[model samples]
Target: MRILLSILLVLLFVPDWSGEPRLPLLPDAAAFRVEQVVLDRRDPARTKLGGLTYLGGVELHGPGPAFGGFSAMMVEGERFTLLSDGGNIVSFVMGGDWTPRAVRFAALPAGPGRGWHKRERDSESLTRDPATGQLWVGFERANEIWRYAPGFAAAQAHSAPPAMVKWSSNGGAEAMVRLRDGRFVVLAEDRRGSVKGTVRGLAFNSDPVKAPRHGFTFSYRPSRGFKPTDMAELPDGRIAILNRRFAVSSAFTAALTLVPRAAIRPGAVVTGREIARFESPVRHDNFEALAVVREGRDTILWIASDDNQWPAQRSLLLKFRLDI
Candidate 1:
């Protein structure tokens, strides 16, 4: 009986090594580690979140700084690459056993102004061509889109579209996606849409950075008070967009919405129908990265959060089974 009481006392007072929240030790460096975290600390067995089924998730940690702020993601097979707004990159492979392997820490080989400052490399959006491995990154503040060679080995080209010049420096190009049909879609983070509840978007017939003038204007209406933060092309050619909303009292909340591929065209006004919600009972954060992949017949969704290098928040990477 005495031993039992002692064990209970320790359990009550000692924090679970895995559950204790810790900030990135190094916020401005490219080194970090990944640890598995529960989907919901409040409800470990709960998995359903609207139309998504929780597959798994991880919390990335690093020395005091330079680790979080991840705003874009790419999931190819078992490899995961997360890109931060400040130009840092983290890549790793997690296999069926959920063990991370081949971990690599790197930064964009080259970017605006030599990437000397965080604002100079505020890469808020990313997209890739599966066939060529070429990548496109949208940098806010500069309102420019840069194309990189496969593996981000080199910056091939960049252009600041006149259309984007007037957008809010910190609110430009928050979401971008390359469709399977050889087109691209770019959405502004703050530019108001033609409609009250929508945001401004553009559809490019060719590479956006190469032919920024070739696309037409469009609009995307998200859930009320939410702004589209990131987007990905679904396997069926539809568009999957992530809508985020946060206030002091509400914290962070997100809505998963979809737009028909056909609705993205010249002078088109598209609406994203809400398919899922991430709030109260489920895992939620300052989610700004989103990616879609396919496994057999199941469609997969990977979402990440930008902790903004704050100790109170966390850099989260979550995987979900997209049923709808």
Candidate 2:
């Protein structure tokens, strides 16, 4: 009996032989290759406030309402899909020359913020289900996510937290991504409670015809000053996050970090790794959104900045090819 008890204790305390911690995930002085940094040269430029530009190639696309506001972006190979946040999810596809293909649009049914108290629609971040190529849009004001299909008219809204409804006016559902599986992970731009500016990663599943379910919840407290705007999982399962600094202070700069995937599970309290910092040349605007793409076996990280309709601030697109 004594020998059996000792063996059990050993099994309980021994480190799992199958797993090892990943360290030094990112190198210091990480060199980010500069791609074409395009300016939103459009007529009536004064009101053409452009934000969040994504580069598929020379086209250098972004979100604008008039000349192309609500023109949000998502990429698949040489083809890129840019959508309008307010309109019926009008999709403008861009191909080889970066010129947009025919426009495909869709609409959504009247629901939570639909009729009387309809919130202004501001789609912030976009992610695709790797398995199905289904599109998910996270709104900045409404604090909601909508799943859409091609050539459709209306989208199916999903269930979001009360915080989304509360912070809809500001930046609500800011950053989100779908896992290899069907579940999703999202982060709020800011909080109203003691944990204001706190980041929560949630995992849930949803269908285009139905609302999403909140399966798990985990909160991550970054270094006091940083706020994550986007997140993606590495091939090996480590989580990579993009941090944005709103204020133009000396300490404000964009950052990239890697954290163990296990550390960010729902209901689990976790922390992240400070792998790289992205600081543009003197006058670049605030970097807001990020997306990861795969070229063959190579992983590429793309970043876009939001020009708050300021002439002095030009929209910027930066790229980094990950070594590991």
lDDT of 2 by residue, 1-324 (tens): 999897777658753322333111112221222234333333212211122222332313333322123224455664544333343233444343544455444443433353222244566667776665566777766666677654333454455554355663555666777666555677766653235545655666544225354466667666557777777766666667777775655533676777676675656756666755544332234556566667777776655555443444444545456654
Specify the highest-TM-score model's number. 1
Per-prediction TM-score to the true structure, in the order listed: 0.89, 0.65
Tens digit of per-residue lDDT, candidate 1, span 190-270: 888787877889888889888989878888888888998999998888899998999898799999999989988766678
- Which prediction has the highest lDDT against the true structure? 1
Deviation in Å, model 2, residue 120 alpha carbon? 1.8
Q: Local distance difference test, per candidate? A: 0.86, 0.53
- Give all candidate RMSDs, comma-separated: 12.2, 20.3
* Candidate 2 overall lDDT versus native: 0.53
Off by over 4 Å in 1: 1-31
